[model samples]
Target: MTRSEATASTTGTPEADEYDVIVIGAGPVGENVAERAHANGLSAVVVETELVGGECSYWACMPSKALLRPMAALADARRVEGASQAVRGSLDADAVLARRTAFTSDWQDGGQVDWLDSVAVDLRRGRARLDGPRRVKIEAPDGSTHTLTARHAVAVCTGSRAALPDLPGIEEARPWTSREATASKEVPGRLAVVGGGVVGAEMAVAWRALGAEVTMLVRGERLLPRMEPFAGELVAEALTEAGAEVRTGVSVESLRRPSTDRPVTLALSDGGQLEADEVLFATGRRPRTEDLGLETVGCEPGSWLTVDDTCRVKDVHGGWLYAVGDANGRALLTHQGKYQARIAGAAIGARAAGVPLLETDRWGAHAATADHEAVPQVVFTDPEAASVGLTAEDAERRGLRVRAVDLEMGEVAGAALYADGYRGRARMVVDLDREVLVGVTFVGPGVSELLHSATVAVAGEVPVERLWHAVPSYPTISEVWLRLLETYRG
Candidate 1:
């Protein structure tokens, strides 16, 4: 059926209404789950307390990318001599912020609500919790409570929240989390970022370009440590060149603020004091499973839920409770969460209809097999870092017979012409026994788009010999694939 046909028609009393499927958390993941369940001829309803699109639509991905894109564009222009000559002055912070506001629709959920209505999935604007098996209780905005029942399944898609480190006075310091960092209207004169992961790295690059003296304190040895060593090396070089002071092996001993208007004082592990107009903690994320009433079903609260290939919560009788997205902790990425939602919805439909699952093998419609075998990510910094599947370190740790091939992206003609003195690197981890690419990493300007190609290779498990026939266009950065295959052959 068409999406518009799915808009819920009427509202009945909560006590009288029962659906085939009930989804918690109206984020992208939950929306997809409801749509998929509806497609399988099951009635569905979605519950959300925040905006329908969740963190990604209002705060995380959309606003963060909107804030970073202008800085990246300016940097790209300044790299070429011809373009560099015409470019002048720092970015207009007000304009960039205005664009971000527009991208977020001024924190409104009208568009998302309309989309849900178009899809025919019922939307309940409230916070929801599991009351018991297939039963949910929602606390509405007006202080009224309503209960919902699911005839077939109840899916949890609450996603996750930014985790802050424990420190004295951290609560009183009024430090910025990712929500504040991405949505702030004004850029601080001096910004200090904690942690060296994707959010920290991208915000440093963005704020530094917007005229903030950014100081990035990483507790680890380098930035992007989860990727190849060279990825962090290239990103650090670029961030330093862009005027961000990146400190590695650093720790925050204490945090203090005399007044809300005053700068934050940070005591370092090395017995030094640092101060900044604003401090951001991009440390990590914790699943949003707490207080979801998991304890009602003999599961632990405030802990990640475990699920099977079909996303059914393990050890639960009858296989009716399902968890997807960050709540499951299989893969934290939004796209991967959506993939799990699709598989879970199909499994629910099959069971409801008493139709046995046709296939549970790899890449099956009822299994989230890709979460383990292939997961792609892109860090949208000035020099973008993109990768898919296993890294060389991961392959080695897993005892796989693998070889890592590295290439300087400056060797590619398109990269050379893309910027003057372009600097970047590419690496491919090849499985010796299978003769197929197990992983790929690209670090350079304009490398974000190259990630999908690598994802296809790893996900498809296409043999290296067969990859030769799929030639990349000449004078393109993608030619690095040919170079990588050639190096592997030798």
Candidate 2:
């Protein structure tokens, strides 16, 4: 009679034993795909090796952001309570790790399995490997083998895995990647970061704030090369202020164990070397598509499965297979992966149910999407940096009419009130022809919270004129938006 009652299905119970759709990798995207498929009246089963929620829920974004969030919360507390005794304290490593463990459900898979059962999506606990078209072979933890045949389609949502660089003895170093780095309990006395990308920069700041002497060896010119130059400059300033020694335009020549008790020494391409108790290789990641029996499916080694604009995995023999998320290399982000999964799920359901699926020329339901146009990104370092869409340099290379506006963040009222000695920058790129917001970069303390506002404006294609009307509150860091618009007009 009610929506809740209607959703309460037999599929969740053991009564609904067989499933029409079997999803490999029960990460967030996998769950999303399963849910979407279920909504389309197909029985869905989600197989997961670990927790149901995946990396963002436990290790990657959640834990990293959790460690960084205390600083943010403390800032808020200090701002609200001038007396300071109301929230007088520092981080307790044990307590934080305990909380993280609780959030991750303590590496136990039963709760997630129960959730899948309640949601009417079958939960299979196993390491899933793709066997062939519309098929998966799973090795359950209980020493049992099972096979699942997906009649509709198979969706791959295996998130990316850490990639170690080719440095002599680097592999032998037994260093921490994002997995160990984010889930670490104790902060090392000295930490050396090997990459300059998002994870490296963010973790460097987080650990440094937690009292680790951090030095970042980046092979790029700026801290976050993916952001605007102005934004990157602000992030670099933030890292330096927090006492992080960032050396750019350098590569790792060699890594070696100095002693059994001491830290490792990393030799650089610039004929310099540094030692730290901990070494983190955040160079990059590749799709976790290896050993999934893709060879049996005839997929290439070098590249990911070839999926169409609709997320239909292409092949010479046939075109029934599909891949999404990190496996597609479309966007190795949780949200983007989930977005692709939704499209793939909907497409499969529509085709199976013989419904004429509505298609769009660009972003909308039923498109693989996220190619072309803008995708928002944020680096959660102190004096944070956030950006969406193409920078002026990228736009020029792509042959777009771009007009850029740059301003020191200190010029805004928000920056002044944020702190007496504020340090950061704000920049925006506008499409001169379309008069729409293309990209925005906000850098400075307490600015990571401001990203979604700009993201909404850009994704909605809010015109610069309309954006001007969308007023940011006064005496807040967001007032930088007004200053930016004024600069653009002038």
Candidate 3:
């Protein structure tokens, strides 16, 4: 059968179909929007060109964590005296690669397809673009087209892509984006990573542990410039200790690779050249809005869509258009994207049912309050760094009356017991005027699990006095919370 005919029989014909909500992109954000809209009695359909699970499920988060977990486990084993003696060999690369493949479901989308089916969200496999307000045009793989109309709202959840710098020969070099890095079958002998952000830092740690001679080129003074300075410092120290050559205050002038099989040669801003088996440019991300046909709806084609408290597109006349997740350019993390999806989906349902949006406050159900008040993220590195809300520097720049309470996490008995020589730091940015934590950061082995407590505190805006009653359990890494609180009180 023809592609159009098949689509009509399987997913319903464009002329005969209309949904209350149409979500572009079937990633976690898109999936959540469809699921939540369904929960509110709205008929929703999700259009996707790739795997429904998106980057996190296939390439970015799941695969990367699967690769990092073994390395972390081995490191901890080596740190303890009794376990250190039992360790005698390096990581099994083949086994590690196999586990990573399993975690990503071998890059298949079947599981995610089943999830959408269970949630009663219609799935259309196509590249979707905004044909006009509340109208989406989708191009199928076989060069057929389908038009979908949204009765209530069209949500942009297409997320973002890895951004490469403008440089000659870089594109032809076939450099490793985050996709290739995490899902790589063969480890590069020498890897050059440019950019000091989360991707750069995490990949540097992962590849170096997996036996790649990683050279990190950071244009800034340190890695993770977005986080607190101490967080970056500790990460740099860990990367250096892992035998990765960490270079700061450097830039790539040009790149040259005559063929895909050839090593990539880089000409540095310092008038030096280095060659590597692979080069990953994890500089940043750009919204996947280039081909969304935003111009037809009176929105800029390649720019981010502005959204209000309800995630409703600001400039659209009838407010039928909304943008969520990385496409909104608010918080780029997956969890934050899911949070926005919940808010945007509910808002669409409310509008469809002719119900008023009652609670639009900072922590309200109809508004993505967590995106502004408390966005939590955990960087999976040895001595993992997890943080939520603002850093001290961010609070100062925002002109908020905040005080930073910094302490060594090693002083906590739980941390010391967790590892023979626990080396890490903790910091809390307290809103002195409100007597509550505005931000919190923890960097140490096994510290990623300790982050949600801080997330709850910041999101709930729990007062300092009330927090004192919420005692952390004795003899756990979470005791850092108690230490931070005590330091603040003093």
lDDT of 2 by residue, 104-202 (tens): 666665665565666667667778887777778889887787777776777777777888877788767888899888888788999999888899988
Which candidate achieves the best lDDT against the true structure? 1
Model 1 lDDT-worst window of ten: 4-13
TM-score of each: 0.97, 0.90, 0.97
Looking at model 2, residue 308 earns an lDDT score of: 76
* lDDT pick, better of 1 and 3: 1
Q: Candidate 1, TM-score vs. the true structure?
A: 0.97
Q: Where is model 3 poorest over a 10-residue stretch in terms of lDDT?
A: 1-10
| Candidate 1 per-residue lDDT over residues 1-490, each given as its tens digit | 3332232324323444588899999898999998899888888899898898998899888999999999889989999999999998989999999999999999998888888887778888778989989899989888888788889999999999999999997998898989999999998999999999999998998888888999999999999988899988889999998889999999898899999899999998878888999999999999998888888888899888899999999998878999999999988888899989899989999999999988678888788888987899899998999999999999999999999999999998889999889999999999999999889999999999999999999999999999999999988999999999888888
- List clash counts for every candidate, in order: 2, 3, 0
The runs of at least 3 residues in candidate 2 whose Cα sits more than 4 Å from the true structure, single-residue gaps closed, are 1-18, 75-91, 258-260, 316-318
lDDT of 2: 0.77
Per-residue lDDT of 413 in model 2: 79
- Scored by lDDT, model 1 comes in at 0.89
